[model samples]
Target chain A: SQQGEEDPQALSIQEGENATMNCSYKTSINNLQWYRQNSGRGLVHLILIRSNEREKHSGRLRVTLDTSKKSSSLLITASRAADTASYFCATVDRAGYSTLTFGKGTMLLVSP
Target chain B: EPEVTQTPSHQVTQMGQEVILRCVPISNHLYFYWYRQILGQKVEFLVSFYNNEISEKSEIFDDQFSVERPDGSNFTLKIRSTKLEDSAMYFCASSEALRETQYFGPGTRLLVL
Candidate 1:
């Protein structure tokens, strides 16, 4: 079963604009994390929101998790051209397993 | 900040051959993991190791796959016999503890012929 599935597979925005990506999961999760990947590069950890947490912030990244809805959203504010990359949402299930089930990801293109 | 490092940034192997992918996780981390991403696909978790043994593994990690923390610093994933379907980007990651933010290493792109 696919756990995290992100919407708007591709997103394009101008520099300084905001980009919002949403992810929905099938089962209960211990935490939901966001990661960024440049083409052919490894995933860079962005932010993590635990099931008990509603929102989290780091630099320009804001992540919100709604366990009741089994959904999450990542908002990158004041987006920069350098932010052009694929953003993925991963979930750690409540089963105590450490594996991360990732989404297909949203490819964000920030234009200058 | 210390980060996970993978050796042999890229490798090409023939079918039925064996290949070993190596990684050096963050020094202070106690948990290590292996994940892979096929071209244009989602990153999938292969296995997770802690305390020198595999704590969890996905269905994708079958008999063809194995993992080892050969030493205090190095963790490795060995594919006994390579398959064309095995070609993908393999990433190593580590975290201080379970459920913590994991730091990922630059992936090793494996191409199986």
Candidate 2:
């Protein structure tokens, strides 16, 4: 079973607009990481935020995690056409190992 | 910029036949993992391997599934008997250490007839 669920299954935005996707998990997590999948290709790790941290940033991407709320959000600032892809949130449980449980994912479409 | 690599971008097999999905992880990585995604579904974890043994596995990984690091660079997942329900995109991932970031391969699309 999947531990996390993402909201706004699909999102469409114009270039330079920001895109936000939210995810919620059911159990306690050690960390949450976001990944991007381009069509039929592999997943690319974007950002990872530990349970102790609330927010993290990488390039134009920003992620905020709220353990109290059991949710997390990924924000892409100044989106571009190339940024169109499926975004997934995976949670690593507090089970001592790093095995991840992923969400259904949010499909983002950036129009030029 | 080393990355994980999977073989035979696509594979087709009969329902009762055995199939082995192969992967070559980053040279120095210690942990390996396998995940699958049915069309229009979330990615699901199958198993995680470290120190030449399985560290963890999901309920989906039943008796039909097995993982092996047969050689220095090759990690393989063998399905003793494939089933129609097994058709999905199988991904291979590896991490340099436990509880760290993982790198994934392009994935192998398997079709069971």
Candidate 3:
């Protein structure tokens, strides 16, 4: 069973706009990580936010985690056509299990 | 800047045949994992390996699936008897330690007929 669920299954925006995707999980986690997948290719790790952290930034990527709400959000600012891809949120539970439980993912389409 | 690498980007096999999906994880990494994503579906965790043994696995990783680290760098996923439902993209990932961020490979698209 999937522990996390993402909102806005699909999003379309023009290039240079900001894209935001939200994910909610049901269990306590040690950390939450975001990844990007291009079409049928592999996933690229974007960023990871630990439970104690509220926000993190890596280049154009920003991730915010709200442990109280059991949710997190990924924001890609000034999106580009190259930024178009499926974004997934994976949670590593506090049980010390290294496996990541991924969400269904949100597909973002950036049109140039 | 090192990344995980997978071989045979695409593979096709008949049902009941055996297939081996190979991966070379980042050097110096200790934990390795396997994941699968069916077309139009979310990625699912298959198994995790550490210290040359299975650490954890999901129900989807039944007896048909097995993992091995033949040497120090290569991690492989072998399916004993492939099924049509097995057609999906298999991904291999590695991390420096438990609970750390995992680096993913390009993935192998397996198509079982």
Candidate 4:
């Protein structure tokens, strides 16, 4: 598996439902971040969780990181139709370059 | 809120032609990067620039590719000769610090024929 790989390549849910996506990495990282991409658009930073931090939240989005297992999960609560997009997990290498290694993203479709 | 901005949202060029994609990173950001995503594929990092020099670049950023910070606000990615495989969405991102959140611009779609 690559350094950053997201499982459940695609997901579908209804409005107000919760969507959870998981990401697993293979090496040490300075931090892990989540990004959202609408169809044919650019990426938007959602949240960042440092390797030493267990969990972090921003409004309806919650992100948890487990350095022990080298895995992270993003949970979007009360998902709205606007939340329908592809969610990607990117890891910042601990080498201090700040380059982002991204995963194969999970496409979430929230239907009204 | 400030955001990175890219020019010519879309571009099409001949395979052997040169293309220069331009970006204006957030004014106050210090670090800048370029990434690309082939349709339906994962986003891949191309290069990172700081202090008017390339800090690190991926293997994909080969001899044909070059980056320049011509002035204070503009960062440009120039491809001396493009290939069909070069067709992808190129994104420009900037951050305040090395480990900080990187804000991305609405990518520029390049199609090489």
Candidate 5:
């Protein structure tokens, strides 16, 4: 069974627009991490938010976590054509197992 | 910055044939993992290795699947008998700490016929 479930399986927006993707998980987690993958490439870590932390930002990326709702959101500000790719959310269970369970992912298309 | 590397960016093999996918994780990383993504599907965790032992694995990782750190830098995943359904892009990832960010390799796209 999958631990994380991403909403808006597919999204499309023009360049410079803001893109938001949400993920919901089932169990308690130690941390949640967002990753980006270009076609035929490996996943690159974007930002990670620990259970104790509410929000984090890196460059054009903003991540927010709400433990009470067991959900997280990734926002890309002023998106560009280069940002087109599949975005995934992985959750590390609170048990500290160290294994990450990934969601189905949301495919974002940024038009130039 | 150091990144994980995988060999044979693409491989084509016959069903029932054994295949070994290789990966070279970051030199200083302490944990290694293997995950597979079927075409048009989510990334699925296969197994995680740490301290020279299997720390955790998913149901997809059965008796036919095995992992080894043959040397200080190389980590490998071997499948005894490949099935057509096993066709997918296999990714290798490593982390310096237990729950830290994991750096991923380019991935080996395996096609089993």
Candidate 6:
């Protein structure tokens, strides 16, 4: 079963604009990570925020996790045309096994 | 930087035919995993491998599915029989440890006719 469900199934923005994507999950999670996937390509790990950590940043990427809400959000600052891709949020549950459950993903189109 | 790699960017097989997907994870990584994404669907976990054994697998991984680390550098996922419903993009990933950030391969697009 899919754990995370990203909001704004699709987002269109212009280059240099900011793009934000939200993900909501149902169960308790050990951690949450965000990834980018170009069309027909593999996923690229962006950033990960542990349950204990409220927020994390890497380069132009920012990720925040709220355990109380069982949700996380990814923010791309100063987005570029190259940043146009599908963004997905993956969660690892605090359960018997360590497995990642990914969301349907948000398709962001950054027009140049 | 080292990245995971997979062979046969694309594979086409007929229903009931067997197929094997190969992967070479980044050296020094202790954990490996397999995932599949059907077109227009979320990426789904198949199984996780560690210490030469399967640590976990999803219900999608049935008796017809198996995983093997044939050599120090090679990991393979075999399907006993392909089905039309099996068509999807299969990806291989590796991480330093369980629940850690994972690096994914380019993925092999499988088409079952």
Error of 1 at A55 (Å): 0.6
Instruction: Give Cα distance to truth, residue A23, candidate 5, Å.
Output: 0.5
Residues forming the 10-long window of minimal summed lDDT in candidate 1 chain A: A92-101
Residues B1-113 of candidate 4: C-alpha lDDT, one tens digit per residue: 99999988999999999999999999999999999999999999999999999999999999999999998899999999999999999999999998899999999999999
TM-score of the second chain in each model?
A: 0.99, 0.98, 0.99, 0.99, 0.99, 0.98
lDDT of 1 by residue, A10-63 (tens): 999999999999999999899999999998798999998999999999999999
Q: Summarize candidate 3's per-residue lDDT along A25-90 as a digit string, tens digits.
A: 999999999999999899999998999999999999989999999999999999999999999999
Strongest candidate by DockQ: 3
- Predicted model 2 interface RMSD: 0.8
Residue A99, candidate 3: how far off, in angstroms?
0.7
Q: Tens digits of per-residue lDDT for model 5 on A37-60?
A: 998689999988999999999999
RMSD of 5: 0.9
Residue pairs in candidate 1 whose N, alpha carbon or C atoms collide under 3 angstroms:
none
| Residue B58 accuracy (lDDT) in model 6 | 94
What tier of docking accuracy does candidate 5 attain?
high
Write down the worst ten-residue block by lDDT for model 6 chain B: B94-103
lDDT to native, each model: 0.95, 0.94, 0.95, 0.96, 0.95, 0.94
lDDT tens readout by residue for model 3, B24-86: 999999999999999999899999999999999999999999999999889999999999999
Better of 2 and 6 by DockQ: 6
Error of 5 at A16 (Å): 0.6
Model 6, residue B111: what's the lDDT? Answer: 98
Q: Is the docking of candidate 2 incorrect, acceptable, medium or high quality?
A: high
Superposed by TM-score, candidate 6 places the C-alpha of residue B17 at a distance from the truth, in angstroms, of 0.8
Query: What DockQ does each candidate score versus the true complex, computed on alpha carbons?
Result: 0.90, 0.84, 0.94, 0.92, 0.84, 0.89
